[model samples]
Target chain A: MTTDTTTQGTALADEIREGAGAVVLDQVAKSFRGPTGVKMVVRDLSLSIRPGEFFSLLGPSGCGKTTTLRMIAGLEKVDSGRIFLGGVDATDLPAHARNVNTVFQNYALFPHLSVFDNVAYGLHRQHVPKAELRHRVMEALALVHMDGFAMHRPQQLSGGQQQRIALARSIVTRPSVLLLDEPLAALDLKLRESMQEELKRLQRELQLTFVFVTHDQAEAFAMSDRVAVMEGGNLVQVGSPEELYLRPATRFVTTFVGRANFIPASLVEGFSASSPDEVASRQLSESPDGEESVGAEPSIFVRPERLRLEIGDSSGQIKGPRVRGTVADKTFSGGQTIVRVKINDDVELSVTCDSASNEARDASIGGAAAVTWQPSDATLLDR
Target chain B: MLGRGLRGFVALSYVWFALWFIAPSAIMLIYAFGHTAGLTQKGLVNLNHLGLGNFWQALKYPSGPVLVASLENAVVATALCGVIAYPVAYFIARKLGPRTRAIVLLLVVLPFWTDYLLRMLGWRIFLSPLGLLYNGMQAVGWHVNYLSILDTRGAVMIGLVYNYLPLFILPLAVVLERIDPLLLQAADDLGAKPWTIFRTITFPISMAGVVAGTVLVFVPMLGDYVTPTLMGGARGLMIGSLVASEFTEGQNWSLGAAMAILLVVILVGIVAACWLLATGVRYVLARARERALARVLVTT
Candidate 1:
């Protein structure tokens, strides 16, 4: 009997999901009037979030990440463009009318309400049957491991507990798309890490699409199935974490996603020494000939972890281009130690190695060293 | 050493309280219980003739009506202030930007720059038979008689409301502004309509301000003599004017002291009743909610 009801519930939910539709942003733009005059917070941005997928909008502060999330939730109005939710235009819909919910950065739980009432707020708004509301609220609380805290007021709970209740409150309504605006930003490091895992697990278990916004790259990369990187009100790149880290399309994406060492292509042997703009034009001009076009004014980007450090002439055994430099600085951070090498008076490259590695342990500041990496590991981009 | 310092501080505070509060109250108590011996001196009282005659006289028909009328006028004025101030306070707190909020708040307190007596006298002139309001009303072809509305209960109530409106708005604005905007956004995200959000969240959270503004206005308006004296002519007699008469015109210090003590007791009782009522209502509502929750849980 229980199995039968569960299946029926899911079937009903699936029908509802079909009616709810995926979130589509059609060239949305938003701006705010400030003392300095009207400033564009979000430029013409278009993106679509798939149903039941963990999508993230990642960027630094003032990068329009939060604004985009708010726009999707209908808390913000687009200056131009239409938003479609569940295939229905929701650009003009008030926040209360949209079938989307947001877990705010500060949790934003009602301090005047108990955990149970907070979770059941949306249900009450829809006039859900009391018994069903209670059941669903308890279930949501249990999902966040806060079932026993239903009677407690939000202020009585710790920060992590409050965040859980916030999650429970947003999810209890079973919104088609849940928007989390840095929900774990206020938590300490350890709590944030654990909550990130919990949030991902909850998203999967509930089978709900999530659109998370955060400036912390690691937090966004860890949980999102696909991440959209934004900068200066424009969408820079959108891809999976590995795809973005390995092949960043722009210099901002390359540095924002993770640490990358950018070396002038002229410094690498065998590449023609030319200005970045000259190389770009050359590559553009040769591109119509059906030949592989090398980047103009090309700069090589290699992840610090991929760079190998050797104490002596190990270029013969190395399979890629090598650079001779002296160690300028070494920093030991629990699991890994970062060594900065000065290749020239104007250039410095960082190499990260495991703390337990013999090369990292033997490396001394001001000592001569050589850094090498495979050609495939180095990404060539127009400077 | 710390304990000795704390003890010293407490003793100093007690001395200050006795000098400022207790000594005057003690003198009043003595006068309320004693009698004056046929105008031998203005401030002298005979301890040997101590009795309840003054209390009896103060509680008689005329004084009783004065107290009742004063209470009625204060209650009506306070209610009016509350109804009118809430929207203004809410607007200033929620709708205005920081710069505008500061300016509005300053305007709310601007009347305080003038003396209270001067403001009441100004009202007396404004509401007089030939005053601005009377002439303006006549000019609008209302055929209303000039100066007729002055010195009436309505005039007294208006004066009280105008005088205490600022007191009501300040505390209400303070409490309303302290509420986080994020909570309102969260409520909207939870699918609460505007009215429901206000009813369930805003109203309940701002109750503290309502009660605080009420007490601040009510307690002071109850004992106000200036507005009633200036605006309330023959018909607007109140406990404050009656009490003043006993001391100044009647030269019955003992009777005035007794009446003043009675007013204090009444105000204290009103305050206590308000507090108890608020707590009782909260308790009952909480119990009802718990019962509702219990029923839902059992049924599920």
Candidate 2:
């Protein structure tokens, strides 16, 4: 596909610019005076979120995901950065002043007020009329499918219900950007899955920008249009869920976002002396008009689902650029079997295969199994 | 169990302990209902019928001065003490961090640990002409009579409130500590302004502590007489003083016993009412939760 120069230019210009529902964070940093010493929690980070886009910050704990979100919400002061909300400079604005709401990890719903009152809180502060406030609150709750629970207090609701109420409270104000800090982390697995669907649907219906923060890669990938993976206070990469999963730009991205089997591979051919970090080059080498550079001695990233496991006499050996391994462990998961095999010397790789086959069920552990994938399936990521 | 020797010994000990505490009150109640001559007979002999005469006499006391005034004054003083203590307790429990909480709590309790009479005397002098307050106020260009507050209802109320404030605050602080901080955060996140948050969430949740603190402060304030006599003079005398006067100065034990019985009944009623209200609130919250669950179940 041809790169749209205008869109790229617009996205670039948006880094320092802000418009309605657009948030720009320019070189933001936050440090805390800890017991040990001054610790840098978030270091010089710059990113722009387009209006009405569901952007996710995916990372482990202490990776500055919450800190960055807090800065945008004006809950935490940025040490140095310019934050703009809806084309207005809001770096110094207090939490109440900024037109942003947050669904905290604990779903900090007011325990005293009913769901209706809680959702009506911000509107009341803005001196919205009673009828309009009621209508807006009801509308927001309806978006989350919680309209029937208007009079219920937060403590009276279940975890999933409380989460929806939290969402309703934030969306009731029609904020330019709704910030969610691991809002579904406290729910049970079943409830969390259901809530994730509800949240996605609510976002679509509301048409508001949502900047979510979570450490769960599956949750981020399943919901977000674009995921910004952060590690150790630095944003490693930002792209669509498919792009991040397929073409991870960094070693951290490959390991953090999904389960990947990294194998040490030698570049037999197609590596140029210049631009040694490009993996796209090798995949497009046969295409005479391709614009990519291959690198030497690259680590090949193979996802679990991409690997095709076969039982044959040619076991413990790779075929067609596929490495061989012995099945050390096999797990029968519902719908899929995860087989762990010794890929290379001192390295173990996990491969997931279809559970519908009786062949996998009959395959015993400690036996040799051949695993192979197409060249396109194996991404040569330069670390 | 009393058939065995060891059991008999334990039973005797328990009976003796119970009698030791209940003996005085039992005797007082018997005499208050009995005629004037019943005290002389002794040994639980010649019990008389119960009559409302003692209560009437107590109410329409010597010189027909309404005895209810002192009781009312005491009740008001106790309520005022609770009002003053709540904010201080809230600050210690919620606002102050660990170290500051300890220091502030100690300061609140320090006054009660000191000599009670001496504290009252200190207040007396403080309200007098040569005290720091009097001198300071005079310097501030206010025309003031330092002795005016002393031997007045205001002075007595102040003394009672000052003495019992910590008793109310300590219990309140303990209950406040149990409340989750997230409850408050939830209120704020729901769009409540600071005042609304405090009124709806903080104030209602802390109601149990308020009742406990009020009973602790008010019950004692009602029975106080020394502070009234020393600081409030004739007008400041509370129900405790009336009870004391009937026995010692007035030589009317029957009337004093009647007044004591009435006070006990009132305190019991107050306690029962508080318990009922608290339980009712809990039941309402639980019912609301059940209804919500039922709705969810039906929808699912």
Best prediction by TM-score: 1
Q: Which residue pairs clash in candidate 1?
A: A20-A86, A21-A86, A276-A297, A279-A296, A279-A297, A280-A296, B129-B147, B151-B233
Task: Give, for candidate 1 chain B, the lowest lDDT window spanning 10 residues.
Answer: B36-45
DockQ of the two-chain complex in candidate 1 = 0.63
Number of backbone clashes in candidate 1: 8
lDDT of 2 by residue, A68-167 (tens): 9989987789999899988789999767677788888988776656787778777887789855665566556666678778777788899888888888
Which pairs in model 2 have colliding backbones?
A109-B186, A110-B186, A110-B187
lDDT of 1 at B102: 100
Interface RMSD (Å), every candidate: 1.8, 5.7
Residue B295 error, candidate 1, Å? 4.6
Q: Give lDDT: candidate 2, residue A29.
A: 96
The segments of candidate 1 whose C-alpha lies over 4 angstroms from its true place after superposition are A1-21, A267-295, A314-316, B1-17, B37-43, B49-53, B145-147, B295-300
